[model samples]
Target: MTKPLISTERVQSSTGPMVIASVLNSPSERTSAPHRHARGQLLGARRGLLTVAAADHHWVVPATHAVWIPPDCVHGLRSHGPFHGWSVYVAAPACVDLPGQPCIIAISGLLREAVDRAATWGEGPMDQRQERIAQLLLDEIAVLPAEPLGLPLPLDPRLRRISQALADDLADNRSLAEWAQWAGLSGRTLARRFVSETGFSFSQWRQRARLLRALELLAADVPVTTIALQLGYDNVSAFIAMFRRALGVTPGRYFIAAS
Candidate 1:
Protein backbone atom coordinates (compact mmCIF):
# COMPACT_ATOMS: atom_id res chain seq x y z
CA MET A 1 0.00 0.00 0.00
CA THR A 2 1.09 3.58 -0.58
CA LYS A 3 2.45 5.44 2.44
CA PRO A 4 -0.51 7.60 3.35
CA LEU A 5 0.92 9.46 6.31
CA ILE A 6 3.15 12.09 4.65
CA SER A 7 2.03 13.93 1.53
CA THR A 8 4.16 17.05 1.11
CA GLU A 9 3.41 20.20 -0.94
CA ARG A 10 4.93 23.65 -1.03
CA VAL A 11 3.16 26.91 -1.92
CA GLN A 12 3.78 30.64 -1.83
CA SER A 13 1.66 32.97 0.28
CA SER A 14 0.88 36.72 -0.02
CA THR A 15 2.53 37.44 3.31
CA GLY A 16 5.83 36.91 1.45
CA PRO A 17 6.13 33.55 3.17
CA MET A 18 6.40 30.02 1.83
CA VAL A 19 4.01 27.36 3.04
CA ILE A 20 4.53 23.63 2.97
CA ALA A 21 1.34 21.70 3.53
CA SER A 22 1.02 17.97 4.03
CA VAL A 23 -1.48 15.35 5.06
CA LEU A 24 0.01 12.43 6.89
CA ASN A 25 -1.33 9.23 5.42
CA SER A 26 -0.26 6.63 8.00
CA PRO A 27 2.50 5.57 10.39
CA SER A 28 5.57 3.63 9.44
CA GLU A 29 6.58 0.55 11.39
CA ARG A 30 10.15 1.71 11.96
CA THR A 31 11.43 4.93 13.51
CA SER A 32 12.02 8.01 11.38
CA ALA A 33 15.58 9.07 10.68
CA PRO A 34 16.56 12.70 11.46
CA HIS A 35 16.21 15.72 9.09
CA ARG A 36 15.62 19.53 9.07
CA HIS A 37 14.01 22.52 7.29
CA ALA A 38 15.14 25.83 5.82
CA ARG A 39 12.51 28.46 6.73
CA GLY A 40 10.88 28.93 10.11
CA GLN A 41 8.14 26.32 10.33
CA LEU A 42 4.81 26.30 12.17
CA LEU A 43 3.83 22.64 12.45
CA GLY A 44 0.75 20.93 13.84
CA ALA A 45 -0.50 17.39 13.73
CA ARG A 46 -4.20 17.31 13.03
CA ARG A 47 -4.30 13.63 13.85
CA GLY A 48 -1.91 11.17 15.47
CA LEU A 49 1.40 12.05 17.13
CA LEU A 50 4.23 13.99 15.49
CA THR A 51 7.79 13.43 16.70
CA VAL A 52 9.98 16.37 15.69
CA ALA A 53 13.70 16.21 16.40
CA ALA A 54 16.21 19.06 16.47
CA ALA A 55 19.79 18.37 17.53
CA ASP A 56 19.73 17.07 21.14
CA HIS A 57 16.13 18.21 21.60
CA HIS A 58 12.88 16.69 20.36
CA TRP A 59 9.23 17.54 20.71
CA VAL A 60 6.33 15.13 20.48
CA VAL A 61 3.64 17.56 19.28
CA PRO A 62 0.16 16.13 19.60
CA ALA A 63 -2.88 17.68 17.94
CA THR A 64 -3.45 20.08 20.84
CA HIS A 65 0.17 21.18 20.82
CA ALA A 66 1.97 22.63 17.79
CA VAL A 67 5.70 23.17 17.36
CA TRP A 68 7.22 26.36 15.99
CA ILE A 69 10.58 25.59 14.44
CA PRO A 70 12.96 28.49 13.87
CA PRO A 71 14.62 28.78 10.50
CA ASP A 72 17.51 26.50 9.52
CA CYS A 73 17.29 24.17 12.51
CA VAL A 74 17.94 20.55 11.63
CA HIS A 75 14.69 18.78 12.50
CA GLY A 76 12.98 15.48 11.96
CA LEU A 77 9.26 14.59 11.95
CA ARG A 78 7.82 11.12 12.46
CA SER A 79 4.16 10.18 12.43
CA HIS A 80 2.65 7.40 14.51
CA GLY A 81 -0.28 6.67 12.24
CA PRO A 82 -2.58 8.48 9.88
CA PHE A 83 -1.65 12.11 10.56
CA HIS A 84 -2.42 15.35 8.76
CA GLY A 85 -1.39 18.99 9.19
CA TRP A 86 -0.17 22.16 7.54
CA SER A 87 3.40 23.50 7.73
CA VAL A 88 3.58 27.29 7.38
CA TYR A 89 6.95 28.80 6.59
CA VAL A 90 7.63 32.44 7.25
CA ALA A 91 10.68 34.45 6.24
CA ALA A 92 13.14 35.37 8.99
CA PRO A 93 11.85 38.91 9.47
CA ALA A 94 8.27 37.68 9.68
CA CYS A 95 9.17 35.17 12.37
CA VAL A 96 10.04 37.54 15.17
CA ASP A 97 9.24 36.18 18.65
CA LEU A 98 9.30 32.66 17.28
CA PRO A 99 11.27 30.31 19.49
CA GLY A 100 14.86 29.27 18.91
CA GLN A 101 14.41 26.10 20.93
CA PRO A 102 12.29 23.05 20.14
CA CYS A 103 9.06 23.44 22.07
CA ILE A 104 5.45 22.27 22.36
CA ILE A 105 2.89 25.07 22.56
CA ALA A 106 -0.83 24.83 23.12
CA ILE A 107 -2.81 25.62 19.93
CA SER A 108 -5.66 27.76 21.17
CA GLY A 109 -8.97 27.62 19.34
CA LEU A 110 -8.40 31.01 17.70
CA LEU A 111 -4.92 30.19 16.54
CA ARG A 112 -6.01 26.87 15.16
CA GLU A 113 -8.86 28.43 13.25
CA ALA A 114 -6.60 31.19 11.95
CA VAL A 115 -4.17 28.63 10.62
CA ASP A 116 -6.93 26.76 8.84
CA ARG A 117 -8.12 30.05 7.35
CA ALA A 118 -4.67 31.10 6.28
CA ALA A 119 -4.32 27.86 4.37
CA THR A 120 -6.99 28.99 1.92
CA TRP A 121 -6.00 32.63 1.48
CA GLY A 122 -4.13 33.21 -1.79
CA GLU A 123 -1.85 36.02 -2.92
CA GLY A 124 -3.10 39.46 -4.25
CA PRO A 125 -5.24 42.15 -2.54
CA MET A 126 -5.23 39.81 0.44
CA ASP A 127 -1.59 40.74 1.10
CA GLN A 128 -2.42 43.42 3.68
CA ARG A 129 -4.86 41.21 5.55
CA GLN A 130 -2.49 38.26 5.35
CA GLU A 131 0.29 40.43 6.71
CA ARG A 132 -1.92 41.49 9.61
CA ILE A 133 -2.84 37.89 10.29
CA ALA A 134 0.81 36.94 10.07
CA GLN A 135 1.64 39.67 12.54
CA LEU A 136 -0.99 38.42 14.91
CA LEU A 137 0.34 34.92 14.43
CA LEU A 138 3.83 35.91 15.41
CA ASP A 139 2.64 38.02 18.33
CA GLU A 140 0.54 35.24 19.80
CA ILE A 141 3.23 32.69 19.04
CA ALA A 142 5.66 34.43 21.36
CA VAL A 143 3.40 33.94 24.34
CA LEU A 144 3.17 30.19 23.85
CA PRO A 145 4.59 28.17 26.74
CA ALA A 146 7.36 25.74 25.90
CA GLU A 147 7.68 22.13 26.98
CA PRO A 148 10.68 19.85 26.41
CA LEU A 149 9.82 16.33 25.36
CA GLY A 150 12.91 14.15 24.90
CA LEU A 151 15.66 12.61 27.01
CA PRO A 152 19.04 14.06 26.13
CA LEU A 153 21.02 11.09 24.86
CA PRO A 154 24.78 11.24 24.83
CA LEU A 155 27.35 10.14 22.22
CA ASP A 156 29.46 8.00 24.57
CA PRO A 157 29.24 4.34 23.66
CA ARG A 158 28.24 3.10 27.09
CA LEU A 159 25.69 5.84 27.67
CA ARG A 160 24.47 5.53 24.12
CA ARG A 161 23.85 1.84 24.72
CA ILE A 162 21.58 2.64 27.63
CA SER A 163 19.74 5.26 25.61
CA GLN A 164 19.28 3.01 22.61
CA ALA A 165 18.22 0.13 24.81
CA LEU A 166 15.56 2.26 26.44
CA ALA A 167 14.21 3.44 23.10
CA ASP A 168 14.23 -0.08 21.74
CA ASP A 169 12.25 -1.40 24.65
CA LEU A 170 10.23 1.02 26.76
CA ALA A 171 8.85 -1.90 28.73
CA ASP A 172 12.22 -3.34 29.61
CA ASN A 173 11.17 -2.81 33.24
CA ARG A 174 14.78 -2.44 34.32
CA SER A 175 15.61 -0.08 37.14
CA LEU A 176 18.66 2.15 36.95
CA ALA A 177 20.28 -0.21 39.40
CA GLU A 178 19.70 -3.08 37.03
CA TRP A 179 21.00 -1.06 34.12
CA ALA A 180 24.11 -0.12 36.09
CA GLN A 181 24.71 -3.81 36.73
CA TRP A 182 25.06 -4.42 32.99
CA ALA A 183 27.25 -1.31 32.61
CA GLY A 184 29.58 -2.63 35.36
CA LEU A 185 29.17 0.48 37.54
CA SER A 186 27.67 1.14 40.93
CA GLY A 187 24.04 2.22 40.73
CA ARG A 188 24.73 5.55 42.41
CA THR A 189 27.67 6.29 40.13
CA LEU A 190 25.68 5.42 37.05
CA ALA A 191 22.71 7.45 38.19
CA ARG A 192 24.90 10.49 38.77
CA ARG A 193 26.57 10.11 35.41
CA PHE A 194 23.29 9.64 33.59
CA VAL A 195 21.85 12.79 35.14
CA SER A 196 25.04 14.80 34.72
CA GLU A 197 25.33 13.83 31.09
CA THR A 198 21.65 14.17 30.18
CA GLY A 199 20.65 16.91 32.63
CA PHE A 200 17.68 14.85 33.73
CA SER A 201 17.26 12.40 36.57
CA PHE A 202 17.12 8.73 35.60
CA SER A 203 13.44 8.48 36.46
CA GLN A 204 12.66 11.72 34.65
CA TRP A 205 14.56 10.58 31.61
CA ARG A 206 12.72 7.27 31.64
CA GLN A 207 9.39 9.00 32.02
CA ARG A 208 10.14 11.30 29.09
CA ALA A 209 11.17 8.34 27.03
CA ARG A 210 7.95 6.51 27.83
CA LEU A 211 5.88 9.58 27.09
CA LEU A 212 7.58 10.03 23.75
CA ARG A 213 6.87 6.46 22.74
CA ALA A 214 3.38 6.65 24.17
CA LEU A 215 2.66 9.70 22.03
CA GLU A 216 3.70 7.81 18.95
CA LEU A 217 1.55 4.81 19.87
CA LEU A 218 -1.40 6.92 20.84
CA ALA A 219 -1.27 8.80 17.55
CA ALA A 220 -1.37 5.55 15.70
CA ASP A 221 -4.65 4.81 17.47
CA VAL A 222 -3.12 1.69 18.84
CA PRO A 223 -5.42 0.20 21.45
CA VAL A 224 -5.04 1.92 24.83
CA THR A 225 -4.37 -1.43 26.49
CA THR A 226 -1.61 -2.14 24.00
CA ILE A 227 -0.09 1.29 24.49
CA ALA A 228 -0.20 0.86 28.27
CA LEU A 229 1.44 -2.54 28.06
CA GLN A 230 4.07 -1.31 25.66
CA LEU A 231 4.92 1.54 27.98
CA GLY A 232 5.12 -0.78 31.01
CA TYR A 233 1.92 0.48 32.59
CA ASP A 234 0.04 -2.21 34.48
CA ASN A 235 -3.35 -0.90 33.45
CA VAL A 236 -5.13 1.37 30.96
CA SER A 237 -6.41 3.72 33.67
CA ALA A 238 -2.89 4.19 34.96
CA PHE A 239 -1.66 5.03 31.48
CA ILE A 240 -4.54 7.43 30.90
CA ALA A 241 -3.94 9.08 34.24
CA MET A 242 -0.26 9.56 33.48
CA PHE A 243 -1.00 10.96 30.03
CA ARG A 244 -3.55 13.35 31.50
CA ARG A 245 -1.16 14.44 34.23
CA ALA A 246 1.53 15.26 31.72
CA LEU A 247 -0.65 16.91 29.01
CA GLY A 248 -3.56 18.36 31.07
CA VAL A 249 -6.18 16.40 29.14
CA THR A 250 -7.13 12.92 28.11
CA PRO A 251 -5.59 11.54 24.91
CA GLY A 252 -8.99 11.10 23.30
CA ARG A 253 -9.98 14.72 23.85
CA TYR A 254 -6.73 16.04 22.43
CA PHE A 255 -6.90 13.85 19.33
CA ILE A 256 -10.53 14.65 18.61
CA ALA A 257 -9.98 18.37 19.03
CA ALA A 258 -7.11 18.32 16.62
CA SER A 259 -9.15 16.43 14.07
Candidate 2:
Protein backbone atom coordinates (compact mmCIF):
# COMPACT_ATOMS: atom_id res chain seq x y z
CA MET A 1 0.00 0.00 0.00
CA THR A 2 1.04 3.59 -0.57
CA LYS A 3 2.07 5.70 2.41
CA PRO A 4 2.36 9.36 3.31
CA LEU A 5 5.98 10.43 3.64
CA ILE A 6 5.36 13.06 6.33
CA SER A 7 2.66 14.21 8.69
CA THR A 8 0.04 16.07 6.71
CA GLU A 9 -1.25 17.83 9.79
CA ARG A 10 2.23 19.08 10.64
CA VAL A 11 2.92 20.35 7.15
CA GLN A 12 -0.44 22.07 6.87
CA SER A 13 -0.36 23.69 10.28
CA SER A 14 0.34 27.42 10.24
CA THR A 15 2.31 27.49 13.49
CA GLY A 16 5.43 25.65 12.33
CA PRO A 17 8.86 26.90 11.31
CA MET A 18 9.45 29.08 8.27
CA VAL A 19 10.94 26.10 6.42
CA ILE A 20 10.26 22.41 7.07
CA ALA A 21 12.11 19.60 5.32
CA SER A 22 11.55 15.85 5.17
CA VAL A 23 13.04 12.79 3.51
CA LEU A 24 11.55 9.50 2.38
CA ASN A 25 13.49 6.31 1.67
CA SER A 26 10.89 3.65 1.09
CA PRO A 27 10.48 0.43 -0.85
CA SER A 28 6.71 0.65 -1.10
CA GLU A 29 4.78 2.80 -3.52
CA ARG A 30 3.66 6.21 -2.31
CA THR A 31 0.77 8.42 -3.30
CA SER A 32 -1.13 11.49 -2.18
CA ALA A 33 -4.59 12.67 -3.10
CA PRO A 34 -5.16 16.06 -4.67
CA HIS A 35 -4.77 18.52 -1.84
CA ARG A 36 -3.43 21.98 -1.12
CA HIS A 37 -1.39 23.23 1.81
CA ALA A 38 -0.18 26.62 3.01
CA ARG A 39 3.46 26.05 1.96
CA GLY A 40 5.32 26.19 -1.30
CA GLN A 41 7.04 22.83 -1.94
CA LEU A 42 10.17 21.70 -3.72
CA LEU A 43 9.70 17.93 -4.22
CA GLY A 44 12.17 15.63 -5.91
CA ALA A 45 13.15 11.97 -5.89
CA ARG A 46 16.75 10.78 -5.93
CA ARG A 47 16.12 7.19 -7.00
CA GLY A 48 12.75 7.03 -8.72
CA LEU A 49 10.27 8.74 -11.00
CA LEU A 50 7.33 10.78 -9.69
CA THR A 51 4.23 11.87 -11.49
CA VAL A 52 2.55 15.01 -10.21
CA ALA A 53 -0.91 16.04 -11.31
CA ALA A 54 -2.51 19.43 -10.93
CA ALA A 55 -5.93 20.48 -12.17
CA ASP A 56 -4.67 21.53 -15.59
CA HIS A 57 -1.36 19.78 -16.16
CA HIS A 58 0.75 16.68 -15.49
CA TRP A 59 4.47 16.55 -14.74
CA VAL A 60 6.83 13.60 -15.00
CA VAL A 61 9.79 14.15 -12.70
CA PRO A 62 12.89 12.00 -12.90
CA ALA A 63 15.76 12.01 -10.40
CA THR A 64 17.46 14.93 -12.11
CA HIS A 65 14.32 17.08 -11.88
CA ALA A 66 11.96 18.37 -9.21
CA VAL A 67 8.52 19.93 -9.22
CA TRP A 68 7.96 23.31 -7.59
CA ILE A 69 4.46 23.67 -6.19
CA PRO A 70 3.44 27.18 -5.23
CA PRO A 71 1.64 27.64 -1.92
CA ASP A 72 -2.01 26.59 -2.00
CA CYS A 73 -1.78 24.99 -5.43
CA VAL A 74 -3.80 21.78 -5.57
CA HIS A 75 -1.70 18.76 -6.58
CA GLY A 76 -1.35 15.02 -6.15
CA LEU A 77 1.60 12.66 -6.47
CA ARG A 78 2.36 9.00 -7.28
CA SER A 79 5.68 7.26 -7.26
CA HIS A 80 6.53 4.68 -9.92
CA GLY A 81 8.01 2.24 -7.41
CA PRO A 82 10.37 2.40 -4.46
CA PHE A 83 11.22 6.06 -3.90
CA HIS A 84 14.01 7.97 -2.21
CA GLY A 85 13.18 11.63 -2.12
CA TRP A 86 13.32 14.90 -0.21
CA SER A 87 10.80 17.68 0.14
CA VAL A 88 11.38 21.26 1.31
CA TYR A 89 8.35 23.23 2.38
CA VAL A 90 8.43 27.01 2.72
CA ALA A 91 5.81 28.90 4.64
CA ALA A 92 3.38 30.85 2.46
CA PRO A 93 4.67 34.21 3.73
CA ALA A 94 8.09 33.39 2.34
CA CYS A 95 6.84 32.40 -1.13
CA VAL A 96 6.36 35.81 -2.71
CA ASP A 97 9.42 35.51 -4.96
CA LEU A 98 8.88 31.86 -5.90
CA PRO A 99 7.47 30.79 -9.21
CA GLY A 100 3.80 31.69 -9.41
CA GLN A 101 2.96 28.44 -11.25
CA PRO A 102 4.02 24.85 -10.76
CA CYS A 103 6.92 23.68 -12.95
CA ILE A 104 9.63 21.06 -13.24
CA ILE A 105 13.07 22.47 -12.41
CA ALA A 106 16.46 20.92 -12.93
CA ILE A 107 17.89 19.73 -9.62
CA SER A 108 21.37 20.93 -8.85
CA GLY A 109 23.84 19.11 -6.58
CA LEU A 110 24.01 22.13 -4.31
CA LEU A 111 20.23 22.22 -3.83
CA ARG A 112 20.08 18.49 -3.16
CA GLU A 113 22.88 18.61 -0.60
CA ALA A 114 21.38 21.62 1.16
CA VAL A 115 17.98 19.97 1.40
CA ASP A 116 19.60 16.88 2.88
CA ARG A 117 21.22 19.01 5.54
CA ALA A 118 17.95 20.76 6.37
CA ALA A 119 15.99 17.52 6.65
CA THR A 120 17.86 16.80 9.86
CA TRP A 121 16.56 19.93 11.60
CA GLY A 122 13.06 18.55 12.20
CA GLU A 123 9.98 20.79 12.11
CA GLY A 124 11.00 23.26 14.77
CA PRO A 125 11.89 26.86 14.11
CA MET A 126 15.36 27.24 12.64
CA ASP A 127 18.43 28.27 14.62
CA GLN A 128 20.82 30.88 13.20
CA ARG A 129 22.99 28.53 11.15
CA GLN A 130 19.94 26.61 9.92
CA GLU A 131 18.36 29.92 8.93
CA ARG A 132 21.36 30.68 6.76
CA ILE A 133 21.02 27.28 5.10
CA ALA A 134 17.33 27.91 4.57
CA GLN A 135 18.20 31.13 2.78
CA LEU A 136 20.54 29.16 0.52
CA LEU A 137 17.76 26.74 -0.30
CA LEU A 138 15.46 29.59 -1.24
CA ASP A 139 18.14 31.22 -3.33
CA GLU A 140 18.83 27.98 -5.19
CA ILE A 141 15.13 27.50 -5.88
CA ALA A 142 14.76 31.01 -7.19
CA VAL A 143 17.45 30.52 -9.83
CA LEU A 144 17.15 26.88 -11.04
CA PRO A 145 15.93 26.69 -14.61
CA ALA A 146 12.56 25.15 -15.30
CA GLU A 147 12.50 22.12 -17.57
CA PRO A 148 10.19 21.08 -20.43
CA LEU A 149 8.66 18.24 -18.47
CA GLY A 150 5.06 19.32 -18.12
CA LEU A 151 2.03 18.35 -20.22
CA PRO A 152 -0.62 21.03 -20.36
CA LEU A 153 -4.27 20.02 -20.51
CA PRO A 154 -6.86 21.79 -22.58
CA LEU A 155 -9.70 23.80 -21.10
CA ASP A 156 -12.24 23.09 -23.81
CA PRO A 157 -14.53 20.22 -22.95
CA ARG A 158 -14.14 18.65 -26.38
CA LEU A 159 -10.36 18.83 -26.26
CA ARG A 160 -10.38 17.59 -22.68
CA ARG A 161 -12.35 14.55 -23.70
CA ILE A 162 -9.80 13.79 -26.36
CA SER A 163 -6.90 14.36 -23.99
CA GLN A 164 -8.39 12.14 -21.29
CA ALA A 165 -8.97 9.38 -23.78
CA LEU A 166 -5.40 9.58 -25.01
CA ALA A 167 -4.09 9.56 -21.46
CA ASP A 168 -6.12 6.52 -20.62
CA ASP A 169 -4.65 4.62 -23.56
CA LEU A 170 -1.48 5.98 -25.11
CA ALA A 171 -1.52 3.07 -27.53
CA ASP A 172 -4.63 4.35 -29.25
CA ASN A 173 -3.54 5.12 -32.81
CA ARG A 174 -6.55 6.98 -34.07
CA SER A 175 -5.86 9.73 -36.59
CA LEU A 176 -6.87 13.32 -36.06
CA ALA A 177 -9.73 13.04 -38.55
CA GLU A 178 -11.12 10.01 -36.76
CA TRP A 179 -10.78 11.62 -33.35
CA ALA A 180 -12.39 14.85 -34.59
CA GLN A 181 -15.27 12.89 -36.02
CA TRP A 182 -15.69 11.02 -32.78
CA ALA A 183 -15.55 14.26 -30.78
CA GLY A 184 -18.05 15.96 -33.13
CA LEU A 185 -15.45 18.49 -34.29
CA SER A 186 -14.09 19.16 -37.72
CA GLY A 187 -10.49 18.13 -38.31
CA ARG A 188 -9.42 21.73 -38.94
CA THR A 189 -11.17 22.90 -35.82
CA LEU A 190 -9.55 20.18 -33.75
CA ALA A 191 -6.12 21.01 -35.13
CA ARG A 192 -6.48 24.73 -34.58
CA ARG A 193 -8.05 24.42 -31.15
CA PHE A 194 -5.39 21.99 -29.96
CA VAL A 195 -2.68 24.49 -30.89
CA SER A 196 -4.44 27.43 -29.25
CA GLU A 197 -5.61 25.67 -26.10
CA THR A 198 -2.56 23.54 -25.34
CA GLY A 199 0.14 25.19 -27.41
CA PHE A 200 0.76 21.89 -29.18
CA SER A 201 -0.52 20.35 -32.34
CA PHE A 202 -2.61 17.21 -32.00
CA SER A 203 0.30 15.05 -33.15
CA GLN A 204 2.76 16.82 -30.88
CA TRP A 205 0.46 16.44 -27.89
CA ARG A 206 -0.05 12.76 -28.55
CA GLN A 207 3.67 12.16 -28.93
CA ARG A 208 4.38 14.01 -25.68
CA ALA A 209 1.70 12.04 -23.87
CA ARG A 210 3.27 8.81 -25.07
CA LEU A 211 6.74 9.97 -24.04
CA LEU A 212 5.57 10.76 -20.53
CA ARG A 213 3.96 7.36 -20.15
CA ALA A 214 7.08 5.70 -21.47
CA LEU A 215 9.08 7.38 -18.75
CA GLU A 216 6.67 6.16 -16.09
CA LEU A 217 6.76 2.60 -17.39
CA LEU A 218 10.52 2.63 -17.77
CA ALA A 219 10.85 3.68 -14.15
CA ALA A 220 8.89 0.58 -13.16
CA ASP A 221 11.57 -1.53 -14.95
CA VAL A 222 9.37 -2.58 -17.81
CA PRO A 223 11.20 -3.95 -20.82
CA VAL A 224 11.77 -1.56 -23.71
CA THR A 225 10.17 -3.85 -26.30
CA THR A 226 7.07 -4.26 -24.18
CA ILE A 227 6.79 -0.54 -23.55
CA ALA A 228 7.26 0.32 -27.20
CA LEU A 229 4.56 -2.10 -28.32
CA GLN A 230 2.26 -1.05 -25.52
CA LEU A 231 2.62 2.58 -26.57
CA GLY A 232 1.51 1.83 -30.18
CA TYR A 233 4.90 1.87 -31.79
CA ASP A 234 5.07 -0.75 -34.55
CA ASN A 235 8.77 -1.36 -33.95
CA VAL A 236 11.19 -0.97 -31.08
CA SER A 237 13.59 1.07 -33.19
CA ALA A 238 10.94 3.67 -33.90
CA PHE A 239 10.17 4.05 -30.22
CA ILE A 240 13.83 4.32 -29.33
CA ALA A 241 14.29 6.94 -32.01
CA MET A 242 11.39 8.95 -30.66
CA PHE A 243 12.65 8.66 -27.11
CA ARG A 244 16.15 9.70 -28.15
CA ARG A 245 14.82 12.65 -30.09
CA ALA A 246 12.81 13.94 -27.14
CA LEU A 247 15.29 13.22 -24.32
CA GLY A 248 18.65 12.96 -26.11
CA VAL A 249 19.17 9.45 -24.79
CA THR A 250 17.80 5.94 -25.05
CA PRO A 251 15.47 4.61 -22.37
CA GLY A 252 18.16 2.45 -20.74
CA ARG A 253 20.79 5.20 -20.68
CA TYR A 254 18.26 7.69 -19.41
CA PHE A 255 17.62 5.78 -16.20
CA ILE A 256 21.27 4.83 -15.87
CA ALA A 257 22.31 8.47 -16.00
CA ALA A 258 19.65 9.31 -13.43
CA SER A 259 21.01 6.63 -11.09
Q: By TM-score, how accurate is candidate 1?
A: 0.62
- In the range 66-170, model 2's lDDT, one tens digit per residue, is 899998889988776677888999888778888889888877778988999999986566799998998999999999877787777777899878987776677
Q: For this target, which candidate reaches the highest TM-score against the unseen true structure?
A: 2
In angstroms, what RMSD does candidate 2 have relative to the true structure? 5.0
Give lDDT tens digits, candidate 1, residues 1-259. Answer: 3332222222222234533333333344324455454457777777555556676665445565677777766766655455466556666656555787666776777777667666676543446677677666676678867755534665456766776677657788888999888877788877888778778787877777787677656666878789889889888898889888877888677567545
For all predicted structures, in order, the TM-scores are 0.62, 0.67
* lDDT per model vs. reference: 0.65, 0.83
Q: In candidate 2, which residue pairs get closer than 3 Å at backbone N, Cα or C atoms, i.e. clash?
A: none
State the TM-score for model 2.
0.67
